[model samples]
Target: MSQANPDRPDLDLSSCDKEPIRFPGSIQPHGFLLALSPTLQVLQASDNLDDMIGADAARAIGQSLQAVIGEQAGLQLVPEIDAADIGQRPLYLCTLGIGPARHFDVLAHYYDALLILEFESVARASAADFRHLHRQVGDFLLKLTDTASTRTMSALAAQEIRRVTGFGRVMVYQFDDEGHGHVLAECRADDYPSYLGQRFPASDIPRQARELYMLNRIRLIQDADYTPARLVPALNPVTGKPNDLSFAALRSVSPIHLQYMRNMGTLASMSVSLMVKGKLWGLISCHHATPCTVAFDKRTACEQLGQILSMCIESREDANELQFRLDVRRIMVSMLAGLTQSADFIDNLSSVFPALLKFARAGGAAILFEERLLTYGDTPDEEAIRELVAWLDLHCHGDVFHTDQLAALYPPAAALAANSAGLLAMPVSRIHKHYLLWFRPEVVRTVEWAGNPHDKDGAPPAAQLTPRTSFATWRETITGTSAPWHGGEIELAIEFRSALLGIALERAEQMAELAEELGRANKELEAFSYSVSHDLRAPLRHIVGFSDLLLEPSANENLEKRQRFLRNIKDSARLAGKLVDDLLSFSQMGRAALRPTLIQMDDLVRSCIDKLALDIGARQVEWDIGTLPAMRADPTFVQLALYNLLSNAVKFTSQKERAVITIRASDEGAEWVMSIADNGAGFHMDYVHKLFGVFQRLHRMEDFQGTGIGLANVRRIIERHGGRVWAKGAPGNGATFYFSIPKELNI
Candidate 1:
């Protein structure tokens, strides 16, 4: 048994075991520990020196190591001790003693201002049979190298480890993002209980233990029931602290962990850390039902197997990532083609959003273009999504933002964790702040822990250092998290973002070119209208003047012929002048800039009606006007549109004894719709399409005179305001003209 230090009486087993065990001032009963000065004089030895080497612990101190273990035995360890370097691996000395009970394998190292030597008993005769063991290990490695998959390699490793180490059970364990481990593969004897699908919590191996695993790839616990051996001084005499036994093969196991092993009915245990790219990935754990010791050479071989397995895992993952990238590129190409072909880029995203969800394997996705939000698949309500977008806008820094546990990063998202526990968002347009967001739902999982993780009794101020003394299966329901995004998935997301941004840039350039072309066309139209106004009007004016001159009483030879000739000149000149004026009006409408303001539609309609009162003089007109919504638009353009529509209604209904005109507006979600109905000499439905074309009059001049550009002007004005217009009419029936304007516009 280990002797306790007088100054450290408060160091209970529970607390000591939970803390770092690398510098424990003790050794297992199956081994002996000694600290010597540089001159080979014993500075300290285990309290059980007599039991181990037949030398009194107190008397061995301050004596030459040769005096305590005899000349021949001491000479064998002297060279190893002298050659040891601090922080280097411990050197192995030859085995000593004669019988099973007394035979010992010695190891020596220089550490922390002292020479440290450890001695453990040789457990079995087969340990030295390296010739046979090497062949077995070599064959196993050949089998491992043949496999490319991590799972296949792990299975092969577990089976071979159990066969070589003579352990009842061997398990290949892998860690998750949370540091908990799950059994990936297992090989077990028929009598042994299977832990193939079990999970071990992070606390099962504390932080310090994990760090040690990284430094020391292999660890062995010969027997969990063995008593501990205390160092003679309880601390290194040179350093006045516990010896740093981080690399010692015979280091005493933590009492709490030993107890835990006992509870699990494991007599001996060995672990080889699987390291990949300098990081601890998992472990190859071997447990025996009886006391067993793995030879140093065998342990080294196992470590080699772990390294090889790590390489295989890395290689396989790299290949998978390559394939995934190729698939993502293909999907991106298809999506870009669809987007480019679409007339409106943002509207096309609706179809593309579904493809994105499939590619990412996400449950939901959302696209935010300015204030417009479109969602697909399973998603939160619009308001909730908007709030999430606002949060993202505030916190996101780079072009892409991703989180597997969104609730942990943002507190407000905790409530939304069930639907949006993971999010991968990309801002496609920094100027517009448009976002493409993908979501993953929370995964409620049942974690199988070795025991209850919490302290069931009561709260303790000091941290619980002891491993629980139970091996019962504990079920835990983990919430507010999703499956972690892998490195490959994040890479794909970044690549996808880059590709989408490239497409958006291309689209922007095309739009710029189109706008430039439209600008040039407008300029040419203005110049043409100016020329037509001056050049075309002169010929008509001259014709009317010459005809008027000829119609004079002195110039006329026949009265009937003169009257007809003068009338023809006046009619032809009037028609030509009206056409020019209409063409000029159409050109001006195209070049006019819009100045939008909120105006009451009711007032605007009334104003238009008042202006047309002169044309309606002495006409019996009945009006029905409903409440009209206030709209944001160019008031001048809106008034012109209303005037043209109302005037058409008044002119078409001239034959009616009581003309009926109805004006009203209705809200249509993103826009407002206004309509004017009239009872008049309406055109046939077949000719309705021609009614809005310039100079395409339906009725004869004798019946109703019009330039026919009135409706065309109304169409152009409404369209410039980002609106749509349509009409429906039949011969001798009333016509209803409808137009809608967007509720908001950039202008």
Candidate 2:
């Protein structure tokens, strides 16, 4: 671990992850670092060249690669770089000969616009038998095919790698998704300390170090206290930055890590990264009690074993999950099928128990549907769950949220972790705060750490990161954790949630349509009641007034007046009958189908005005009628719509000195768009949306008498003809009502 910024060097755990470990600007003393330009000229070299290869590193700068190391090394590097995956995986070039007795194995790779060459002394080169390594890996691969379980395979792997490398202790360390490492399996010498069942903190191998292990595949530290060879130029000349030693086999490690190694009583170590599905799964960590080195050929054998182990782990886990996957799929299908066949999903709550919990592999399940909490199986109390739902509304609203250790993410859950340590939440609806959740019970297990992971040393704050001096096993009993949720379980949960959401959405659509129909029925009922009382008022008043006049005692000889009263009574009765017909028509428009025919709009507008003038009497009015066209429509409904508009125009503008009503029609695209304008006491535009809503009136009945169903009826009539209606208005500026009928509609 490199130190954080000294100015603000607070020892936070994340300091390790943020350390820049790749470009340490140095290499271990076991090898030489020679940074070269893209054209093969040496740009920088390690100062240890004098001791390592008996050459002056200063003279190597600005010099061709052949003149610096030797002609043989240069001849082998060009084709190797071109043929290899340079930036990611380092390529091995042919060895170089400095003398008859002295040979160096060279590796070449490129990054940051610079090509680099690392030369390591070929110590005991002939002893690195490739044939022996081949036999070791071959024997394992043959047995690997027969391996059945991950634990069994891990055990075999630990034994095989320890045999190949001759390390005192070899542990198959597996990392959890949270970055904690657990020694799953191990093989060790008689005198070696056993760490088979122990755990290690994630900070022991920071995120960057773990990433480097992923890229390199194999990394070795020959001696814990080996001196690092410093680059002569410190920085690369071409890039003007610290040389990127990400792919270097001899890259220097952090000093804090070296100290950690010494504390563990390990002088040498080699780590082979275990990658599964392109992610770092764990490591084949080898530790030696004495300073030791494993040759390149043997390290390659170990790396290959790690790869094979990763594949076996994936295959074995898949095999284990196959039955569980099938069961979950079956239960999900049965539940959804039942839900779709039922009128209400809540009626199928019986499945939330053993079946639903087993589907998610949880101890309990719940649904926050329709603002109610429904629980089954073992779960937290209603108070705790309601609190969780509130928190989820802010954090995981309208999405899928899950956690194996619920208390870790939501601290308040600590009180409830015993019964609900894990939670899987899926939002059922974005429109409502509805969700589906699953819970897992606390497993109540003990963990053994190599040392106390949370113990802080008595040293000062600055020394907080100092390596622990103890490797003694420390037992800890976990309280708030449950059985881990597998990726397959989470994925299956998502699919089930999606299928259930489809049902939820379908139900919502049906409910919306039903609600709309109910709303229209209620409004029409209100308008019908208002129309009966209102429309009959004038007619009833006329009948009563004329009869009173006809009953005058001295009017026996006045035959003309008596006849007039009788005619008036007859007219009022006819009007009352017409009002009843209008009420019935308006009430049935919602279900009534269109009966369309050719209609002359210009003639229709004139007829509507002539009828409206009967009620208007001698009021001053002006009508500006534009060229109204002929179109195919329901003549009766269209005439009714026209009558309502003409009547409204005359009534609302009754306050005006000279009421101006304008009617216009024009061809608009594939529809005949018409507008009726009025200079009346117009309403505010903000309430315009309510104008066409049933029984929604903007003015008082005392000012302008109406049943408040006129605009709504107009909308229904126009829409029945496959047309649309809209209005725009501002206070005192008057209004313009427009309606359009599709020109191509045969209805």
Candidate 3:
């Protein structure tokens, strides 16, 4: 195997720079390196150039490049060398050699004012079979579109890559949210042990290695056992440091990685980066049991496949996420409807807690409303959860909050790590301090490492660079963490919070109204007493006077007078009872709980019309029921309000030959405006302010038989549903009652 120094014992990794494997200033002996000045004079040549190219290194140096490689070959390289510049991508030059019939793969790059060239021998058969290689790659690309999922696509890619490269094994590795990787798909010989489903620590591919993969999409080690060829000069004379081989196609393998591969009993390996959205997603890793070399063309084809696979993976993941979001939206609509209809928002949410938990795939959920905490599923005790909420309130920003590693973020969470290792909390109300929280249980799992990671003697020198030698599986039981929360899940949580915020605002408005009502409590009580006395006193007095008259002996004989008084007394008492009943109905409208539903306004209006048929008997009532839209509202309350409006329309239009009562609804941007119009005994516009007030009537009882509380009840019900009510009318003209309800359910 290649080594940085034959005399150096093991490897050392203490210094970040000066790591021998990183700055090897060498290439594998299978290839020779050459450096030329801008004028084409050779400045440096590898020591082994004589063995492979029949050129003495000492003699080649300071000579014209054309004299060393032959006039024709050197002339062909001039244009390529002149085009190259520092940091420029390496260009592939035609294969050529001096005094040898062997085929060489030549590449040229310019760096630090020098044109560097590398040559490695390749099989002539590979070069001649371009058509065959193209056909194979084309077949893979054609089948890629038909792949149904990432896993299936990955498996097909692995198999096709193994076939193209003739590698012993090929694996598709996928990285998780935490940067750890696992073997997602594999294609290997029957005798090869499976690494499928095995997890690899992030340490296996360190940060620097990952960065290199992004820069160089493909890397290859043709012979793990081949000796490394040292550069003629150990450092670039211009830079006074090892040449930046970051973009080099034939850069030497890291010594630590080589030692790792040797321990796995692999002689050759290659890796192609899988990128998605300009980020390194994973890798397509290939391994062989014997020294192997793939031609440049084949490697290029594999790189193309890697890019195709990356796009496929991205598309599949996006498609899946879209479907998931659709499902979430469906659930959210149902939940919102429930919340609007519910008398208490928190109670309704608790009832649908299971669905909420599914939003983030959490193991437990809790709702903190009005200073009370309600928990569901698997959760920590109430007290601990309260503390968690407190912590979140202090630390969390914005309305939605989340973390996969709760223990790491909040120390107190460590105590309940088993139950609340991950948290997704959202504040439903900023003022009321209402919150919704979801938790994921700790997922204790055993991770298998490729080898024993510990030092051999339980201690090692700090600067030692020797990679672990054993390939035995090392098991580690991880705790205090759960499965990570994905970006999609976080987005869903934020959407859910937004929906809840609407409900919270409605609740806040209702509370404000209640506060206002409380401020006027004393005045309302005084008015109630005055109304009771003024409305009920006459009936009681009439009853008493008629009874006293019947007690007179002479009056007992007066049958007509006695009958007249008895009838008058009964009429007054009945009117008094009706008034009391109307008052009670008005009060109940405000206190009754709302059960909102997606209501068909037409059906509701029709039902109300049918109920008012008795009052419209034998009348030529022309019903103009226009197209009505659906609304989210309490069905029972809406029905009651419509009944009152329709009844009033019929009663007031009694004077008309053809009573036209029209019910129609129109979209008014964010709300639906519904109108109930009638050619009735319309009131003056001056009394419009008192139209919906309690006991406020437009006509006398003899004109319209009503307790004058119908309009009041209608106004109350509509306002409770986050709506408004108003009227337009003039004396002797038609009246139109308009009410509007929000398009979206808020309360």
Candidate 4:
């Protein structure tokens, strides 16, 4: 930071004027990335430094990279770096095992240090990895478990998955409360499939398939047709009779499934199941163009990685939920502190939802047994979501539940075949009872909702659903429609719902209280106005009445002197009455609401002219009105503002034989700039401040018939419309009254 100095000129040296250092090499090994200033002071460090700088890398990051890496290594590496080598240019690269703990590859580059770090772990004691995936599963669990804003978390999780798997595409698939599935993120690949923003049908992956996914956690069928299928006995663990193996990892291969994958032109596929409390939540799927296989060891590693990634995603989501609750609390506190009324709060409650969340996208919401069609950001959807509680009042009637249960109520119910294809109705558990139900139009493909794979030899006969009829059906089948209740989208609604629920309710309460306050204030103002009308008029009447009384006596020899005195008294009384009226008008201006109406300038000018016709006719004044555009404004106020200017022009130019007043209007994009110029006795420029002041006049009362409030009223009216007014003139030059009115209100 540059220190402030009174002696030195404030010269900023922050411009992009310096060339940066670059490195030169091929096949760069990742290393401790660092950014340095011209003086070689460390400015930034890569996140991979922990693998290089030992355990103290975080603490020592601020130190010079050259000093930390040692002199010999720095000198050898220095000559390799040049300006030409920037983002991708690399230096000394080597993969070395540090101790017996882990293996890492280091790459020194001019732009930054790149380091590739890999960790190895056993497959069976994979609790840590499972925990990580559990976190992700937990994240999915949280999606179903709690109402929270997971936008931030979902984005982060998507990014994390993309980073970890090195897969071209990775997406979060979610099952709607209705058991429909949809894709959340496409995480594009090289020539990434245009599946993004596309929908898929629920029947693409049958109930048997989804249940198997939940139990397996990961399904790595490198080539759907080539991978050996696991066959298990149909005998149930608890019963001696044959039972379904849909949820079993050892199910016989369905030939139709293989054919379907081949038809889709997908050579390989891998997916990590995301489940909540043993129920299938969704899946993280990765696709490959060429036929490939994951070795058992590699498959296990990838699964563990998936698990870790999932857990991190879930943890991050939980953190975000906490933050959202905090934010809602903060906003509510601010509103409560101000003592606002509940109704007023409700009127403006929608504004509280952050702009990032497209609350209007939510189609309908349910609370308990009541379902309500929603209009963006209305009362919290919790009440509406609660209405559906009656349906989930009990668990599945049979011990075995599957997608078959949903067939009776939901569309393409076969899509939920994971458990039994609708076998598991939404449970009436505590989580469901306390949660909100958000329904949207599913707009993307789901985990198991594979598109028409173009071939039929490898597909399973039972896996096929009836062919779609319309393009919309094809579109939905390809993308996977889940009643639009996507995991991320619904997660977002939950987040916003939870955060804004309390604040919105509290604001409503505050708004109601504020309304009462406003009513009381209005009543008080009316009382004050009544008293002023009575009290002020009493004295005014006395002055005028007494002056008239004195005028009645005209017989005395000194009658002329008496008459002059009476005239002076009468004149003073009239001035007072006019001032009182002007004061009342100014006070009323504050209470008026803006009622913008289309006002033709020509009409407004003519109206002012008609009002001043008697005076103009008596004085023999000439007027010039130019072409004007139509504008929106308070017609009455605009007319009054114009009238004062034109009348002033007439008064000031009374000495001229041909007193000319010109009214002209010009459009200025967003406003109308109107000018009234006159050949008048313009005053000194230095005294312009008194022009629009109440009771402040430039001329004596004998020469001008002004209460000094006319210009004041004009200025106020123009300002109320977010416009400005000013006068331009010299002592001898004529004056121009210029004011502007906005085309649109700032609000």
lDDT values of the candidates?
Answer: 0.76, 0.77, 0.76, 0.49
Question: How many clashes show up in model 3?
Answer: 4
How do the residues 1-747 of candidate 4 rate in per-residue lDDT, one tens digit apiece? 122111112323222121010110101112233444444444444333455445343444446545655565455434434322433322223333443444433333332222211112122322222234445444544433334334334444555555555555666666665565666666756675645434354455666566556555665444554433111121222334333322221122343444545555555667777654446766677776665544233344556555644554565554464466446445544433443334443334333333322332333322331133223422223332333334433322211122223435544433422222212122211112322333333244333334433322344544223232222223223232333222333333333343333343334334534664567435544644554455346556766675566556552235445445545554554455445545545543434556788988898788777767767777768788889998888876777688778888988888787788888888888888999998877777788877876556777757766766678778878888899998877765688889998899662
Task: Report the C-alpha lDDT of model 2 over 1-747, residue by residue, as the tens digit.
Answer: 233322123324345676567877778888787887767788889889888767788888889877876676556655666676766455666566665666667777777677878877776544335677678877988777644677778888999999988999999988987788999999999999999889998868987898898888888888888877778787778878877777788888877787789989998999999887788989999999888877677787898899889988876664566557667779887777667666677766544456788788888888877777889888888888888988987666324788878998999988888778988898765334677888998888899999887763455556567777787998899888888887667766766665665555455446645764777656555655564566668787998988788678644346456556767875675555344434434555655456777899998898788767667888888899998899998776788798888888888898888889999999988999999999998889889888986557799877986656678779988988889999888788788899999887755
Better of 1 and 2 by TM-score: 1
Tell me the TM-score of each prediction against the true structure.
Answer: 0.64, 0.62, 0.64, 0.29
Best model number under lDDT: 2
Q: Tally clashes: model 2.
A: 0
Error of 2 at 178 (Å): 1.9
Candidate that beats the other on lDDT, 1 or 4, i.e. the better one? 1
Note the clash tally of each candidate.
0, 0, 4, 95
Error of 4 at 200 (Å): 3.2
List clashing residue pairs in candidate 2. Answer: none
Ranking of candidates on lDDT, top first = 2, 3, 1, 4
